[model samples]
Target chain A: MPDRLLLAGLEIRAGERVLVRDGGFRVDAGEVVALVGASGSGKTLSARAVLGLPGPQPGVVAARCSVEANREVHEPWSGVSEAFATGRLARFRREVEARFRAIRGRIVGYLPQDARGALDPLWTVRRQVEEALALGRTPGRATDWLARSGFRDPASILPLYPHQLSGGMAQRVAIALALARGSRFLLADEPTSGLDPTVQAGILEEIRATSAEGVGILLITHDLRQVHRVAHRVVFMDTGRVVETLDAADMDRARSPEARALLASTARIAWRAFA
Target chain B: MRATLLAGSAVLWLVLLLGLAGPFLPYDVVTAVDPEAIGLAPSLDHWLGTDHLGRDVAWRLLMAPGAFVGPGLLAVAVATTLGVTAGALTGFVGGVLASTIRYLSTVTASIPRFVLVLLVMTIYGSEGWLLGVAAGVAWAPALAEAVHQRIEVLTRAEFVLAARAHGIGSARILLFHLLWVNGRRMVGRQALLLFGYLLVLETTLSYLGGFGVPEPEPSWGNMLAFEFGQHTANPWGLWAPAIAIWVTVLATGIVSEVFAEREHA
Candidate 1:
């Protein structure tokens, strides 16, 4: 009913170099927003800034940013987390952090780009998933989430460490960690980047199924084909600025040169696949 | 290297054996001084001869571990706890606070180690706790600086970012994830190095004649003090205690090297 996430009047500057100038977007509950772009585009930085990864470097500023701490309860979420405790990484306002604290693992989840590297190599899958649940204060069996994330045999997989898991399996475990925390909105940053196509398809299907269940996802990917197939709205970015926003239906009519180039590249990939 | 390791292990084990046997051993170092046999060459009756006080040099060497080991262990334990806590907290919570801590450690470290020991000695009255407190304070700053550098590197590690992204609290992440996971081996190596420092410090104090356990206590340093400048003629009196100190220090050095090598492997 309300916006799940919002970013308006955003400007990112590193020294004299402006990375993102006048960039902003929003996603309501139960919607897929795929941010598409080329290399050195501001897509990843935008997502990281929202997630509060790096502190605003010494000479940077943000105009407006807000996240729905709990969409169902209508709690307030405002102010950048960098201000909470910079060296500690991400921490929001006390009330906002408290509300979001109640919501994360249950309402919002983050799936990092490097799924295998994201997992602690020394820890078993079971321990990692369980700790996520503990941190999220979510009540669910870890095995159920593992299965929900498409693990056929969670019992066998849970005992293995990250090293023992194949690329696809590690990616799935990352998803399971998100689901176990009660994630209704997933911020997946290239969930299938390095996996084989078959595995990539399976992962995409899981994401689609997640969306079908009314969970909003801000899918960060460079793949236009995946964007066409999954994203309801495509927000195209170029050189750190949001240059175009298009409905999935109007992709062929992409107005900007960058968007058109993305379409053409995906067209080439599709042709290669068929030929 | 293997032979060095064996030699080191043997010297350490021999010290431990003598330490265990010290209270029960037959030699009465203070009263058994054979005035007639004083400065006699090494023999069955007196295995390493006598000092100027006519006390058996071997008897004192055997008894010295009790005096040396307790203070060394105390200093190491206190220094490690303080150093690790100081370095870890400073490194994790960067900014003005980090700079302030770095400044404090620099100030503390800049004071010469011997001066700091003397300061602690004067405060605590130079009794059993003297060496422990003095050396503990003296050693902490350097160890803290080393750990600070190590933790700073870990802050940039991907796993650390991943942990923060997952909503793990800052304290848990700093302690369990960053410090505990990586700092364990480095702490152990620091302990071995500190033990060697404490031993060397205590012997130096005894050799200087004012700071150690005092007269008739039989520390390696004081035994050397008793025969100062006489080793040219009565080398046995000087060399016995000197060899004990050298062997113990050398053993610790070898053990520390092996520890580092094993870690790299």
Candidate 2:
């Protein structure tokens, strides 16, 4: 897959139930793929699988997964059972984990679902931004990224802590942290659910801006309006499966009952009330 | 709040100063044994009255900081250091290691730690350093448990996930980002709490006459315990060490509550 993140076969199981089974999807560079479904459809879990997080699950298996062509595709537990059998111990999986960590923030940055609590409550905005910059070893470029994220006077905002900032502002800072790594792939999980409607639009604009700059965006969300506004394509998922993938322009033509139900729900949310 | 914090800090600094200055203070009355001065009421020559052995009670009271505060500080330092290290390692590197640490914390917490302090002093002899070691060892599990929980919560935090995604190694994330950065406030609170705990432990252990600095070396615990030993019901002398202990404990608690809160924006 050229300029895309591809996962051929991915399975995640906790104790008994598989959260995501036989699931795979891709987000090409500069493309936005919104994984839309009702709660617990494993949309967020599927994105986490890309980050090598095994979830709260005991085991996760990914036979093939990749961010772009020629980039290493991690399979953390591919040989786990085999490693258990040969008495060679958990060595292969350790290497797999190390390799996975080596690529995490640099290759892929995540904006977590819980925006209000995403930044450490104790850390100043400046300190957090500096840390993110320093992680990529470009510590002096805080103002550059802060401006890119749309902060007009970064000096004023930098001294404030997470709790001091509005939910919308905090979300932008989180996005800035992710982009600070110069990640090619961005994972935005419910990035705007808990913010003011006006603020939500601004945050979406930031995400849109990031995508326009060529970052592949995997937008995991339930709001279909966000899907229409930001996503280039939507992956309709239900009960641990990728039910369908269609262009955002074709969302009205979605045929699956789950897709129709989600679209109908989004339509039912009156925009006039927000106005 | 600011007033309480200031007052508590003043008391704490005073106690610390006394403890550090213990070596320079005149301690002649600690070993003074005189039948003539026994149970003497307060006189200008013998301030705060003399104890049963005629030792100057004020001089002994001055020794309280050195005898109790020193050991308490050492124990809190040792326990917190060990606890933070153990908690960070176990929490950051999960699997058998995390499980094992969880089990160890459980085992240690289940024990009435004070009993362990007593037992160690009983078995290892009544050396002051040994008592301090026992106090530190006994409290390590409590700190370990607190830090373990803090680290686990932080590991799942979105910020930490962001850090990890940035290709920061697990060690850096655990020690610097998680433990030091996120966990420092928690450690401060724990330190203050442990200081109070050690204060109580040292006093209690000393008063019970087991590892007490042994009468001549004057500690708050023995000062109070010394009167009850002689059945002398003089409130003036009895109240001296009692008030010291109470003030120290209260100051530690107030300071912790007021100042140990994490610096938030």
Candidate 3:
């Protein structure tokens, strides 16, 4: 199988502040890549840059950024570099919008950090999921996907707006909506941040099961426990740079000072719980 | 609840319509002064008694809704279109354009509405169209200011941003979605409020000798103005037209309040 996404030296900046410096990673088909970092560590920015959320800043340069998928090399997702060099950000924005429309619901799904904010308040849960499916599929197929997204009582949910739903239910609806697009890559930023531990585990299990079914996930989070539970590959970032990458199995044996420190802290916490 | 409110307003509106239409049909001539009926008081022949001019008070009351209601409705329509459109556009397209329009509307609104009406009457000569134009000019700025504020609130809503993100064109978003969906309430409320103001403005204009051509034509305000001197002799002469104005304004208020409540619900 081909790699779902390949990034080389992806750089991001916000005005004069260099938020993400020379970040590069790839998720092969059917892989879950957990990007673990502390808060303000550019993990979210990297994900946002990949998803083409905010346009890039001036004077930001990307040395060798390229994204390849399905054996076709897409134009460099270097929004900042283009803004600085060509001053054609408006044209570039149109191109990005067009590209996003084509690929977002078809090949890439984005799970924003705030699940409530991700959903429209006025629309019912099922309608939101239906909208996501409609973006990429035939009407009949979209209905089928909505049904399969764990909505057994789709009729009831279809009429119940977002405010009426529980937080966990809302997050599930967000996930279903994202998945309904039939996207191959899921960029989930803190998929279970505000949920209780039990709900978080349940959500993580769903994410893991979904990833097993040919979905490549770039999981942006700060939870080390979650990293241990579901990550197939680990990319540790610090201060806007990808400092280390390791197999999930070999994460304990990693020697980079930052990685070792993270592992050691997590180990102490685990041991303390047992003790 | 909504249905009940709407039904009640509909009934009130039906009554107003009947009053307006009652004059055009074969009824006692409103301005037919019967000298023989002078000081005759309410009787079988004159249901609401005769004015000092010996005109049937009932006929005058019946004719009152027609003269004012047509012009009021017309003024409301013109003012609403101009006001809401200008307001929605200015508010949605913020910055220099919005500020300039806002400033202009403020200046217009700041001037006494009666002063503006007098100015318009001076220029346009108190014909029915001029009456409507005068009332509309006086009313538009207030309605526009209201619509502008409402649009400003809706422009910041998430759905609008989402619509933009969907690559929907600005014009479609403003017209098909924003204007009707979010703006209907403000416009409806303004129309009702303006209806009351329209009555008062028309009455004021007539009192100042601005409405109707010469003798046959009669306005409720003109009748009231004529009867003001006769208050001690026959208060009903003044009271009849005064009551007409009061009922119309009250009906307008009730209908508008019901509409606003339903919209919020």
Who wins the TM-score comparison?
Answer: 2
Expressed as tens digits, the lDDT of each residue in A1-275 for candidate 3 is: 37567655767766777788888677877889999888898887776555455434453444543444545555445464656577777567666556544544466667777677666654566666656666556355434554554556656666776677766666777777767766777788898988999888877887887788878888988777888899899999888898899888888787778777877888898899999
What tens-digit string does per-residue lDDT give for candidate 1 at A1-275?
55477766566777789888767667666788898888778776676555555544443345566666454643322444355336432333445445444544456677888888878766789988888888777788789889888988889998897878998998899888877766667788888898898999998888888887777888889998888788888899888889898787787899899888888888998899999
Write one digit per residue (lDDT tens) for candidate 3, span B16-134. Answer: 68546855644447767787776446778877787888887777766665666777778888898889878987878877887887788888888898788778778867777677777
Model 1 residue runs over 4 Å out of place are A1-3, A22-32, A54-106, A120-126, A139-170, A194-202, A209-214, A228-232, A247-250, A269-275, B1-62, B111-128, B223-265
| Docking quality (DockQ) of candidate 3 | 0.21
- By summed lDDT, the worst window of 10 consecutive residues in model 1 chain A runs over A73-82
Instruction: Judge candidate 2 at residue B7 and give its lDDT.
Output: 92
Cα lDDT of all candidates, in order?
0.76, 0.78, 0.71
Question: Could you report the DockQ of all the candidates, in the order they appear?
Answer: 0.26, 0.53, 0.21
Candidate 2 lDDT over A1-275, as tens digits, reads 44678765677777788888778788888889898988998887788777776522245666567665236554444554455457554546567677677567777778887765778777788888888787777555777788889888877888887888888888888888877766778888898988888988998888888889888999988888888899999999889988888999999899998888877777777555566
Which candidate has the top score in lDDT? 2
lDDT of 2: 0.78
In order of appearance, the predictions have TM-scores of: 0.76, 0.85, 0.77
- Candidate 2 chain B minimal-lDDT segment of 10 residues: B256-265
lDDT: which is higher, 1 or 2?
2
Chain B TM (all candidates): 0.87, 0.89, 0.87
lDDT of 1 by residue, B1-265 (tens): 8999999879877776775566677646543766666676777877887776677777887887766777777888888888898899788887787788778888989999988988778676777567886788788888888788888887876666667667666688778766765676677778778877877888888888777868777778888888887643346889888889888988888888887775454
